[model samples]
Target: MSKHWKKLPWIIAGILVLIGLLNPPLLPWILLILVSAAYWFLPRRGLIGPVTLPADDAFLPSQQVQWWYWTGHLFTDDGRRFGFEVVFFSFDAFVIMRDQLVQAAITDVNGQRFEFEEFLRLHLPKRVKDGFDLSSGAGNQVTAVGGDGHDRLHAQIGNYTLDLKLDSTQQPALHYGGDAHPYRFGGYTYYYSRPKMATTGTLTIDGQTFQVTGNSWFDRQYGELFQAIRQGWQWFAIELEDNRQIMLFDFKGNDSSVEKSGSITDANGLTTTLAAHEFEVTVTGEWTSPNTGCTYPSGWEIVVKGEKFTVEPLVKDQELRANHDLWIGPVYWEGACGVGGAVAGQAYVELNGYCKCLAAKLP
Candidate 1:
């Protein structure tokens, strides 16, 4: 027991003794004191203990804030390409809290899209086993980093199904404080990312199954409370042909100025930290979403070490209008891209909070 807890009984006894000495409603004071002490001392066993890892990398489940995120880009043997995101979010809020939500989506360069989101409340259909796998009844979603440190994922929505196996060639990239220091991002989450994972699996779209092989990204963030409303971020992940992975995040302030940071993990699993002012991101063009009229940065010209790179989307309309509570709870654009210039690679870009604090803009 903590020192504070050890003194609790003495404190309660002292209060009761004082009330009896004063001779003021002894019976009521005794009853109230006993009830309060019992309530305070009662054990509130939880599913998880002290955080063994930050929100992004966990060895055990969290009772507070948690989410399992997986996103990837794959190509068929015939050069047809696709992208997908399977995520499960769980957190508790004093109010305005939905227990959990499973969001899954798949997109193709040919303009085919499929998305499934289900809001869960009191009886949210989900299970977190060993803090590594998350299984949800929402569209049969599962995102797990198994003992071998590979991601096994599956999701089905109508005629669209994403079944992929992701093997981590590099160690996890810790973006912020790990378990020892969990004060970042509202003191809730320790964040990390698997910038690139070698992926192979079957993707069924519109009843057509295709064998695909490509790279994907995995991000995990969990904590007691992730108060992201302070502002949002522009997240980028790039995987070079040489197996080098680069990731950058521009955390935006209310006025839109960005705080740039991220990491670069080499092919050999060595990570070089990128601090603020180490890099810059600039938009080369914009795309106005026909669905919500939200203008998003379409083409990007990102610069690092005085070298510039240009990236273009596989499709201009990769915006996910997840207006429902079951999804990201925000309107944002997440898509695969073709990178050129300084690095030849495939990339993924996520743009959020452009219209407001996390997808508040709508038609």
Candidate 2:
């Protein structure tokens, strides 16, 4: 794509915003047209450059949005288990400025406790070379930085402090078939996941610390995400006992239709894309958050490749209510679950756009 052609969308958006500001009565109509156009055009595959690992894993400020996410299950020497999530997000507010936000959470399965914290900051000169170096909160309370699948993660919230090192064991599973053209639910994104990562870390709470070993999942996605988030999504990453990893996505459009897609990685690091009819998920129960009053689906019965599995949350109240302060804050459920029935494994599920309180305010 030429430089001028690449700038067309933002130029058109700026014009639309100006027109909306000049004519107050047309703002809603303008937004409706923008959304409609996005839905109609974005799903078609886009052409792009080769996507290489360890380098493309770095921050791409050129894109409008990007995020590095990690979710894992850890255990103590005895038997206690825990789930942890740490994500760093970067959203382009302008051509030269970006909004950086970090969210960290820990679910103490044995203790039946969930604790999380959020931090938001602004950075100028949208540029990050080589790899990602992200931190949030005062004195860097949360930090995650690495290249490829070898990474370090740290977070401190409430009485829990987690530090872990992750080493990749398998190749990344590229979603939407391949990197040549990757688009899902009306948006273009270079999405891939490192599903098998050997994790070693320490969890310190109160005054004691325990050495932990487990597995972690790494996801890196960037590109057109503004339209995708408006449509809600339920994402799952499951690591089975037989060394197979599956990543499933159920995206709901603005018109209330559901689109499903996924990728499965075998023990030998081979990944294949799944068609819509190859997988299905049914909600078995619901849980209402006391803090946000959002009713989220609790238990799920997932059928993949004709095999049935039941997934139940380790902690029901894993909702994270964002403390809004100049960034888009939406309450979301990112939690750990155990898989049974046809498979015995661990999974992480993320549910977004469930709470009307903050979701309705998103752009």
Candidate 3:
């Protein structure tokens, strides 16, 4: 694991891009898929030196494609409960164009789904203040105050508008990495999460509005998006009733070998980094989408650190087609889930990469 060897993928990609100048159509695409496989199969051997992290509010260099992600559970005043996710991705480095996207989805307990996504390529400016403050300078916006642990989420599209405030209750952040340095998969991200938070807001659908309040989870991942991850990933963010939280992500690959990483944040906010071999995830049920005929896992039995849990979706039809083909492509399953077995809790489950062999998020 030398630094020189780690630079090989970019070198190859740059060479392909240069060659693509003459062979426009074919080589560029070949390069795209090649770079993607690098992230999918490449073996990451930790880091050279420890990188201090949980750097909440910390950002990557503007040149790298990066994003801020948040997700949570909500309970409406009338007793309707649902799950939601808000994600921002700046794809400047990947496309050679100043492209950015904001995507949000809500999945209700009764199997109903609503999705909203905004992609802006030519616009004013993507502004950041006090570290985490983000302004899209458009009708759709998300802003996070660095110290307040407060985030304002809003969007206006067609006849629907959503506005919510998230107040994080977990502190110091959950840093997923080595003893001192942050762990980065695909070699470009410094990742962390506020596993438990309080959320309140108003969501307007058509002409009606609903007031909601509940618990949530916030994940902040920033850095190189074009680092290349070939197959998509299956992820889970689970919150137990005992003030404990767990986040697990496994990058799916073709050979049936998946790269696993996760962390458990206890009531005191201390995090325990999980080794890949320390857990096992088994798919217990499958559902085939009539739209694409792509089958996705519907039930899971996860054994982590010797504890077992069963996860089942609150609704079977909770799928979202953000259709972000220019960057991360494919239709994915993201919805609220119920957790049983060793723990009784609520969770958000995501199933991606099931639609095709070559789909990924650059970082």
Candidate 4:
């Protein structure tokens, strides 16, 4: 039990003793009310516990914050290419209500266009044993019903419909936090990733269907992280041609300090944690969003283990501007990118906290 919890029982005991001395007849009723309240308020064992290797894939609704994220690069048979992103988020607000959100986007690389959609609702669909089936509106859904490596994703926005199946090609990469203890950025975070997944499916644009195949990255994180995301973060998931997959995170605190952490998984499913000194990242360019007036890093030159990679967004403007009624216009950048230099590959980068307005709205 936490230090706060350790003292709670003592305080409650004192209250009961005082009530018994003052009014013996009412003590039993008061004790019954307290017991009932504890049963309803406290989280159960499995819902809040230490994260182990091969972390559980089920949705943790009791957690303060959690998300399932996917990003990939797809190719068409006729020489066209595209990039896609789909993410589901679940969070509890002030211990009062639960909120669910889904965000989907597609980058038409050949068409030089980027389109996205999002929906926020009060409740989420029930999840089954270690799996989830979530849908917000018509033609937007993400389901992984079997808890197996095979998963299906479907989303449609504008004139594009992205329907893909992802199968894990390697074992799950348990992050350093999961290797031993949970990561502590804003709070205790249990994080894991399925770095390399074989992707195959169809993408429809303007009623023209095309068969596509590619690779994808899956990320799952849940914790008491309500304050962690508000500060800022730069996350990258890269898959190189040599079958080496990497996941990197740079979390920015309120005092302008950056904490760096990463993990590299080889072709044989062996993962090695990367310390802060093992890698470096430099900003190569910047782009200002015309819609939200937020200036974001446009390009990056990241180096790890003496190997350098240049990453730039497939399209210059892949920013998502969210204007939901429940939120105060949170704006951020998450997009598909191309990698070059020591080894060629594809990547997805997420940049958050670029807009100061979000912080200003927070109490």
Candidate 2 lDDT at 118 equals 88
Positional deviation of residue 281's Cα in model 1 after best superposition, in angstroms: 0.5
User: How displaced is residue 145 in candidate 3, in Å?
Assistant: 6.3
Better of 1 and 3 by TM-score: 1
Error of 4 at 161 (Å): 0.7
When summed lDDT is taken over every stretch of 10 residues in candidate 4, the lowest stretch is 139-148
The clash numbers for all candidates, in the given order, read 5, 0, 3, 0
Residue-level lDDT of model 1, residues 179-294, one tens digit each, is: 42233454445566777678999988778899999888887765554545345678888877777778887766644443457777887877777776777888889998776777
**Residue 136 in model 4: shift from native, Å?**
1.4
Candidate 3 residues lying further than 4 Å off, grouped into runs, are 1-59, 122-127, 133-137, 141-148, 157-160, 178-186, 225-228, 254-258, 323-330, 357-363
lDDT for model 3:
0.67
Error of 2 at 62 (Å): 2.0
Q: Could you tell me the TM-score of candidate 4?
A: 0.83
Candidate 3, 335: how far from true, in Å?
1.7
Candidate-wise lDDT, in order? 0.67, 0.83, 0.67, 0.78
| Better candidate by lDDT, 2 or 4 | 2
Q: Could you give candidate 2's per-residue lDDT for residues 107-135 as a string of tens digits?
A: 99999999998888765212345567778
Poorest lDDT segment (10 consecutive residues) of candidate 2: 122-131
Q: Report the Cα lDDT for candidate 4.
A: 0.78
In angstroms, the error of model 4 at 153 is 0.6
Writing each residue's lDDT as its tens digit, candidate 4 over 1-363 gives 455885686597678868876998988887787777767875552235555433357776567778888889999998888989888888776337577888888999999999988888776445556676767655345333324566788888678888889999888888874632344544657788887889999998899999999998888888766666776788899888999988888776655354788999997989899998999888899998776667889899999999999999989989877747577755778888999989999899999888766642333
